[model samples]
Target chain A: MLKYTEDHEWLNLADGVATVGITNHAVEQLGDLVFVDLPEVGAQLAKGDAAATVESVKAASDVYCPLDGEIVEVNEAIVNDPSIVNSDAQAAGWFFKLKLARPADADGLMDEAAYLALVG
Target chain B: MSDTTELGKTPLTALNARIGGKMVDFAGYEMPVQFPEGVMKEHLHTRAKAGLFDVGHMGQVILRAKSGKVEDAALALERLVPVDVLGLKPGRQRYGLFTDQNGGILDDLMFANRGDHLFLVVNAACKAQDIAHLRKHLSGDFEIEELTDRGLIALQGPAAEKALAKLNPDVAAMAFMDVKDVTLAGASCIVSRSGYSGEDGYEISVPAEQAVELTEALLADPDVHPIGLGARDSLRLEAGLCLYGNDIDTTTTPVAAALEWAVQKVRRAGGARAGGFPGADVILPEFERGASRRRVGLAPEGRAPVRGGAVLFADETASEPVGMVTSGGFGPSVDRPVAMGHVATSLSEPGTRLYAEVRGKRLPVTVATLPFITPRYKRA
Candidate 1:
């Protein structure tokens, strides 16, 4: 199932792993992505922690951790070439995979309907 | 995002919105930050073909001498700025600086001698202060008339000449820094063969009512694209041109800003006209002996751009910062991250290594030569 954060991060939960990436709305507003900084694997992150950074030609923005978890893996492709995030923000642009602290906690995140309405 | 209600609208605001400009508040003006083409493409387009910029928000003024002689106006203006204004021949312009009592730059400006009067263009944010500075000093000898009925625009890039020549063929014969009264699209314009972008271009000041017509005529060309502030900043940063308030301010002196070349030999020590402008005591000495710190280009060793306000250190893990980046970003033309900053004079030499602190990590950066791309001005 997919979930969203008010901060514009989207996440997909499968088994005990949650895949995270910035929302398409963020890519639209960021103009052009020139750089991306991803978190290191195995780093313990709390909810609301700044885990990654996305830099456009004009400015930089932080992508926050939606829920407490351990970063199990990160997308090195986004770091190598950030334009992928602007081109495919939801699927191929996923930033990291987190081992959830509590798998059931994923239910607390906003659903597609709620996320869409909030962004609108 | 600021409250757009209070933002000032330029003459080109309506036309800008019609062209997909993402209007934003810049220096309190509702100016475009980018269009649908985006900053990266807009910057590249300006480097390759042509890009039109609405610079109406900048302050424009005309200075005429009370004695009815242009030389008197030029001489009176010399007391405010450290440039050889008297040596500025008619039909030509020169880059200049307004110095303060402490030898710091008040504002950087361009002044052109139009045979009978002087034309000056200054930054929008500092326009009021700059005009006030002029009035307070030269009111006794000159009539300072701020051009409120006009708007300014620039057409820049490699194809800028070809695009602009389509409107006025005489523009093709102009050289860098040349200024002339020309007719474009049936409107009178003060056209100068100069621009902030490192490309060969022209800055034309036109009647406010005719600005839209003039802009539309230029954009009608296949090569000219409407650019916004985002691309303008990147282009100027890549060109090693200083943007007021970001790169040079009251805290930075012209000498330390690596703009000594603009301070002509005629204004220096032992010259015909020496030590006349404000802060000459402090600025004059720097020509012989350099300042404590100097501005230099920075090449970030990583893809992440070392942007303005990033603190600079002499080495990794250094607890104290030796300098700070004044301007930086990805250079679309060079296809690499480029930046400029001020550092301790001893560490200002090209190839000298410095570390910039970004997001709690120290990134390696080298002091590189400025204008990451070689200047492309069509100098005679």
Candidate 2:
């Protein structure tokens, strides 16, 4: 299932790990995705904290963490080719995988239905 | 202040909105930064086919001399710039710089002698200042008029000429740097064979009232699609054209910006004779002995794009910043992250190794040859 924050970041929690990426709405606003600065594996991040930087053709935006966690893995493929975010922002364009520090906090994020309404 | 009231709108604002463009503030104007297809798609399309850009934010001015002799008008213009305007033939254009008393550039502009008048196109942000400066210094005999109600559109690509020829057949016959008065879609216009992107293109000036209609007519063609400022920036960057505020400014000299070529030999020879221009003493010497810092193109080792204000280091461990990035982004044509920066003169040569300090991480980069992609101007 998908969960989202007010900043437009989405997290797909599966088992104990969550896959993080930005929403298609955010990517569409950014125009052209040029570079993705990946967070190092094992780095601890706090809820609502900046985790990575996404540079587009015109500007750069920070990707925030949805919940406190430790980064378990990052998508090196997206870093090498950022157009993945432009083409598939929510799927194969996943930024990184994070092991949640508090599983219960995931419930606080908005569901896909709520996110759609909020973005609209 | 109310955002809508504060932001200046282009003549084609309504049309851009109708086409689903993402409008953003650019140099005080609410212009389209990109369309639904996105900047990368727009940029790549322009490279392969024709892309129409609404560059109506740029200022257009006409200068008429007292005698109406193009040569005298060119001389009067030479006082404010270092270009060899006297030699500018009718129908030809030259890129020039408006300088301050210290030889620093106030703005880089294009001057075209259109038989009966001198046409100038200045940057959007510096237009007012440039006009005021010209009025204050120019002779009373000259008349300077600002064409604020005119809209400028650029159609650029490998097939730009062919596409534009369908609208104005004479456009294909025009040579590079040539300008002429033409009527398209029943509107009187001035079309010039010049553009910022290193592609064969035309810059057409039309009345503001007919801007939307002309744009629609051009877009009606299967080859023409609306482009935005986002793609415009990337295309110019790939072509190695400098952005005024980022790549150059009042603090930057033409010499440091690697624009000395714009200063012709006649200007240098007539430096002392031509007394009114700014910073003649300081600029002329730098022409002979190069500036301390020069603008150079940089190609990063990987996909990590370096942005403006990023520091450059000689070694990887966050050494003292030798220079700073000016304009940088992914060059759509080259499919690599390219950047322009001002580095120490000694390190400005092609193939020089450097490191860009981006967010505390040292990214390896090398000085690369410019016009990162070759320009395709129609010379003949």
lDDT of 2 by residue, B225-321 (tens): 8999989999999999999999998878888999978887767744544435788888888877999999999999888778889989988775478
Sequence-dependent TM-score of model 1: 0.98
RMSD of each: 1.3, 1.8
**CA lDDT of each prediction against the hidden true structure:** 0.92, 0.88
Clashes per candidate (backbone, < 3 Å): 0, 1
TM-score of each: 0.98, 0.96
Model 1 ranges off by over 4 Å: B1-5
Q: What is the lDDT of residue B307 in candidate 2?
A: 83
Relative to the unseen true structure, what is the C-alpha lDDT of residue B196 in candidate 1, on a scale of 0 to 100? 96
Cα deviation at B177, candidate 2, in Å, is 0.5
Tens-place lDDT digits, model 1, residues B1-380: 34546888889999999989999888878899999999999999999899999999999999999888889989988999989999899999999999999999999999999999999999999999999999999877789999989989999999999988899899999999999999999899999999999999999999999999999999999899999999999999889999999889888888899999988888899989988999999999999999998999999998988889999999997898999999988887887788999999999999999999999999999999988887789898
* Model 2 regions more than 4 Å off: B1-5, B269-276
Tens digits of per-residue lDDT for model 2 on A1-120?
789888988899998699999999998778678888888899999987889999887678889988899999999989888889888999999999999998888998899999999989
Q: Which candidate should be chosen as best, given DockQ against the real structure?
A: 1
